[model samples]
Structures are given as structure tokens and as C-alpha cells.
Target: MKKLFSFLLLAFMVVNLAHAQQDPQALKILNQMSQKYKSMNAFKATFTQTLENPSAKVKETMQGDILVSGPKYRLAVSGQEIINDGKLMWTYLKDVNEVTITENDAEAESMSPSKIFDMYKKGYKYALAGTEKQGAETVDVIELAPEDRSNPIFKVRLYISQKDKTLKSWQMFRNNGNRYTYSINNFVANPTLASDTFSFNKAKYKGVSVVDLR
Candidate 1:
């Protein structure tokens, strides 16, 4: 009985030790990338977003440009534009010539251009998945699983350039087996952006309908 008790205790200790050994390398790289992005005053990027679902046999791709300055951002896609001025958000639908205005809820976890950089800081367990070569650069792939299992998003994969510590791409895996991928084609750091770049000027769009949902 004594020998059996000692073996059980040893096994418990080993299990506890293994559980305590979380990888710090992945967290370090993510922190470095976040710091580099936070240091920049403003930036612009052209990106391609792809949504795919193998089970549903659906795939769609769209190209867009984003201008971000702090919490404010203007995202212009093919048929729509989203402008957030830190307090209010305006989503303009070019097809309908209408704009929906709503309050920008800061408490929500948004995957917008301004919030994407530091998104891994909360509600996630991240680890360095692996490394892969993309074109001429080697990228570090980090995998993040949401702590809340009930969350719609199951996993998020971030690809960071190993050379410049810049984010190359990120992919989101949804609970419904749908995946969304965003890849940056071009990036300009600390660009001379206008002060009103993030705001929606209603006068600019002549004869447009506005729907206020705020």
C-alpha cells in the first residue's frame, strides 16, 4: 500500500509540472508584434479577405484597403465601406446607396483593422504552431484557441513575418466550420493620413439614405 501511494503521488506531481509548462516563445513573439504596431502613429494597408466553407461548398474573396489611426479606422471594400470614428460606426453599402449608422461598441471583441494587432492579448490560449515560407519571407504561425468554448470563433491563426515582425496574415476558424482569411498585400507605416479619414461625411455622398441604428 505504501509503494502504491508513493507512485500515485509521483505521477500527480509529473502531471502538474507538465501543465505548468506553458510556452513563452509564442507569447513573446506576439507581444513584440503588438508593440511594433502600437508604436506606429498611423498606417494603411491593402488586403484580401477570403471566406471559405468546405462543408457548405462556399467560397468568396474580396479586396479592400484600410486606414487606421489608433481606434479610428476606415475600411473600404469592393461594394461597401466601414468608417469608425472611435464613437460611431457608419457602414455604407454602395449597391443600395445607403449607410447604416450605429454606435461603435468598444466593449465588444471586434476583428477590425484597428483592433487586429493586439487581439491576442485577451481570452485566448496561444502557442507557436510552426513556421512556413511565404514567397520570399519566412513566417511564424501562431495558433490561438478561445478560452470560452461557446464563442462562435473556435480558433485564430496569425502569420507573422519573421524578418520584420509584421503581421502577414490571419485566419479565423468558426464553430460552423467556416474559415475567414485576411492577407495583407501592401502596408504603409506612419503614413500622412488626414484627420477626417476615419469619419463618414454624409455630404460627400449625394442623395444617399441614412439609417440610424444607434
Candidate 2:
């Protein structure tokens, strides 16, 4: 009887230990930060995207407020507006005064990677990319490679904050040999939002026609 009890206890402990090792250290931290990224049903923040190619560097500085829910999102820059009400993605270029709408796909590929709350859960594999100290903070570097390498996005490296266990910045490598890097600064969390904010407003832009790209 004593021997049987000891064997069962050992088996239980072994199973728990195995489960603990399932997720890599970096992946575990990323998931925790994802909670903050996932908490707000809708939020608004300023976004700046800079694309660098070998020959030339294109920098686009656009400040926008974003409202996101489930798979739907609506983004409106200072003088521009974009809507994706789950079924269609609408982009209004204020400079050109053109509205482009694209049908939402099952894969949701139209959405940018930074919009992702859970990248690893979407079939991304992560590996440790060593640690580095920046000023007074220690940052953990992690590299994520996609299982399906079909698109221009080949791999991504995330520089995560060690103290807060949050992502600081990420660099995405493209197949064309050009890398895209994005750093999110001054992220604010706003949980209190209206449901209608994510919906499309056709009347607001009376003259703009929805250019269908489906």
C-alpha cells in the first residue's frame, strides 16, 4: 500500500513538471503582455509606420485612433478614416480623397501583425534570442518564425521588457530581404468605448465612394 501511494505521487509530480515546460520562457512572457493587448475591447492611439528598403526609405507618420472588437476594427487618423466591420476593410486616403474597401477573408490577412493580440497562438514558433541590457533595464530578445513561410513575413524578433514582462518593439523580416520594424510608444489603455465606434459610417463621408477591392 505504501509503495503504490509513493508511485502515484511521483507520477503526479512528473506530469505537472512536464506541463510547466510546455511553453518557452519568452513565449510565456509574450502571452502575459498579450493580456494587456487583449483587455481593451476598443482603444485609440497614435500610430507611426516607417518602411525601409535598400534603395530608399519611406517614412509615414500618421496619428490615428483605433477601435477594435473581435475581428472588426475602425481606425481614423487626424484627417483620414479606415473601417473594418468584420466583413469589409475600408481605407480612406485623406490626401487623395479616395476610399478603398476590401473584403475580409477567413484568415484575416488584411490586418497588420501589430494588430495581433496572440501571434504564437496563430501557429508562430518562438526561440530565445539572448538578453541585452539597455541603460538601466534588461531586455529579453526573442525570435519568432512562422510555420508557413509563404508571405513576405519570414520571421520576427521581439525586444521584450524584462521588468514589466511586456513587448517593447518588434522587427519583422520579409522575403524580399527588406525588414520592417515597428516600435509602439506611449500605449494607453481605454476599456470604456461605444459599440458603434467600430461600425462603418457611410453618412459621415457623404461624397466618398467605397472603392470595392474584393
Candidate 3:
């Protein structure tokens, strides 16, 4: 489940440079959203994730929380906690009472939580899909298609709040007939986080097993 969550989250860390035929309106909205995120020093958010596979008739929902500060982040979901302090990553699995440590490689094309802020600068084609009313607020919808047809993901959709320029939800459509959705329920911007918030403390988990892959 941890690997699945990570894989799904990383799918959002994809984008491509703008093209001549790119939609200006979509780019404008994306830029605004990116700028708003970049201005934040630290943030915490509670979110819910849903995975549905219509062909297999499988559906599951999970709740999670994330704390991010620059390139460092801590993600907690479904009995697993992943912590990254820019250069190192620690994944603690509660079910097994084990923690795996590894080096953080940004060039690996894998997803990092920080990538969510500026993913629009990567290999994708995007356009403003439409607008909708969500409760009392209006939302701007954007759809993204990967430039590489071989990618497992077929499409990515983003729902941004027009009033606050914040992301409300995102969904990914996979070629395997599976869809993953993430909805932000609560967000606190510029939160005061401790210096060691992204670091893993081995002492706290007394008898936990440690596997260092770095």
C-alpha cells in the first residue's frame, strides 16, 4: 500500500515545456498556482485518497497527512510514514515494525512531494478543461496529457480553487483502467515547523528493525 501510494503521488510530478500550441489560459492558471505554492515556507495538509479499478471492481479509500518544508517532507498514511530530509529518505512501516533508509535521488524521475509545486515545467501538454462550482467557490479545471505515450498514466486532471488559487483535488487516469483521486480536506500554510520535523529518530521506535539501503 505504501508503494502504491508513492507511485500514485509521483504520477503528479510530471509535465513538459510549453509548446507553440499550448493553451495560454491553462498556462496562466498553472503559473499562478505554482507561484502561490512557492511562496509558502512550510505547510501541512490532510487529504483523502481514493483508488478505483472499474474493470476489477476494486475500490479503496485512505486518509493521510503531509508536512512539507522546502525539499523536505513527511508523509503519513495507512500505517506508514515516509520522511525525507532533502538528501535522505526514511520509510517506517508500522505493520512490520521496520524502517528502511535510502538516499534521495532527485534525478531518478521518481516523485517527491516537492515536485507537486513545480511539476508544470516538465513533459506534458495541458489545457484548461472547464470550470465548475464546488460548494460556494468556483473551480478552474485543467487537464494534462503526457507527451510520452508509453507512460502508464493516460490523463491527469487538476481542480483549483478560483477564489484562493489553491489546489482542491487532483485525479489520475491510468491505462490499466484504474483511477486515483486525491482531495485536500484541510491545509495550513506557513506553519511553524521544527528543524528536525523531516528527520527520522531511530530512538523513538525502540525495538524497530532498521534497514539501511543508502
Candidate 4:
């Protein structure tokens, strides 16, 4: 679940491909997608995450929502709520009624939400995989591979709408044969956000145990 949440936080990585291995067509689409998201002041999105492991005969699905404003974000998924205020983070477990506070570690986050649309400037090689139909809309499929062979994620596939360049879905394939796919159901650009949106509100979670790890 932690791994799933981490990938969700990173989301999509796009833009600035100077590598010879990178495909020109893919770069153009990625740059456009990056600019589209970068132009937004804040956004809210609802998504569905699907996890599958054929060997283990396991399949699970969860619905979640996220609010992002620059480096700060609030995410609720799979019975867990994570709030990061750019400086600190509060992770609340719904079942246990516990919240753990820790200092935000940017270096530890390989791909932070704020930089999601442009983090592909290094450590990745991407190319245009092809095009496919997503529902009634046609989408351009872009495939991303990590330059570091040691990376657990062997490949990441992104489905971007050809008409608007909006991200429709993305899939991550791990070396262990576990596949994680996330589909964006709804997205609102530049939504009105409250002051406390990126911070955990203990008052709302009555009698919640606080574990300050900072």
C-alpha cells in the first residue's frame, strides 16, 4: 500500500528530453502535457487505482481523490489519508485512528507531485509507444523506462488524450510482476482550495492518536 501511494504521489513525469534515445514525437506530446499542468495554479482529481498480480491471484481496486497546490497536497486512498504541507507531512490511518507526523523529505521522494509533470528531465528514457482508443477518445501511448537498471519499476506507460493532452491513465510494471494502473476519472484545473487543505485537521478526527516522528 505504501508503494502504491508513493507512485500515486509521483504520478506522471514529463518534459525536456535531450537524450538521443528519446523519440521526438513523444517529447512533443510530453512537453505539451507538462505545460498544460504547469499552467494550473491548483487542481483536484479523482482517480481509481487497480493492482493485479496474476501469479499471486490477487486483484484489488480502490477509489481516491487528491488536491494539489504546488508542493503541497492532500491525498486520500485505500483507507489512508496523507497530507503534506511542503514542509511537514501527516499520515492518518482511518482504521486505527492514528496520525503520524514527519518532516517532508523531498530528496526521498523520487518524484514529487509538484514536479510530476517535468521530472523526466533525467534518469528516464521515453518514447512514443503508439496510439489507442480510451473509451471514445483517442490517446497517445508513451512509454517510459528508467535509465537505472536497478530501479524496481521496469516500465511506466502513460495514456494521454490526443485532443487535449490530458492524462487519462498510467500503468507501472514492477520487476516482481505486480502491475499497478491508475486512471483519472475527473480533473478540475485551478480549483478553489481552502487554507487548511494541505494540512491535517486533528480537530476533525476526534481522539486520534498523534505520533510525531519529526
Higher-scoring candidate on lDDT, 2 or 3: 3
Q: Pick the candidate with the highest lDDT.
A: 1
CA shift of 47, model 4, Å = 0.8
Per-residue CA lDDT of model 2 for 120-180, tens digit only, reads 6665667666898756678888766666647457567777788876566677766664666
After the best TM-score superposition of candidate 2, give how far the Cα of residue 139 lies from its true spot, in angstroms. Answer: 3.2
**lDDT for model 3, on a 0 to 1 scale?**
0.84
List residue ranges in candidate 2 displaced over 4 A.
1-23, 55-65, 76-80, 108-115, 133-137
For candidate 2, give the lDDT of residue 16: 46
Cα deviation of 13, candidate 3, in Å: 21
Model 3: per-residue lDDT, tens digit, 97-147? 999999998855244667765665686788887999878889999888767
Cα-lDDT of candidate 2: 0.64
RMSD of each: 8.1, 12.5, 6.9, 7.1
Query: Which sections of candidate 1 miss by over 4 Å?
Result: 1-22
For model 3, the stretches where C-alpha displacement exceeds 4 angstroms are: 1-20, 107-110
Q: Give lDDT tens digits, candidate 1, residues 106-153.
A: 766266778888877776777787899989999999877766667787
Question: What does candidate 4 score in Cα RMSD to the true structure?
Answer: 7.1
User: Is candidate 1 or 3 superior in lDDT?
Assistant: 1
The candidate 3 region of ten consecutive residues with least summed lDDT is 11-20
TM-score per candidate, in order?
A: 0.88, 0.71, 0.87, 0.87
- Pairs in clash, predicted candidate 1: none
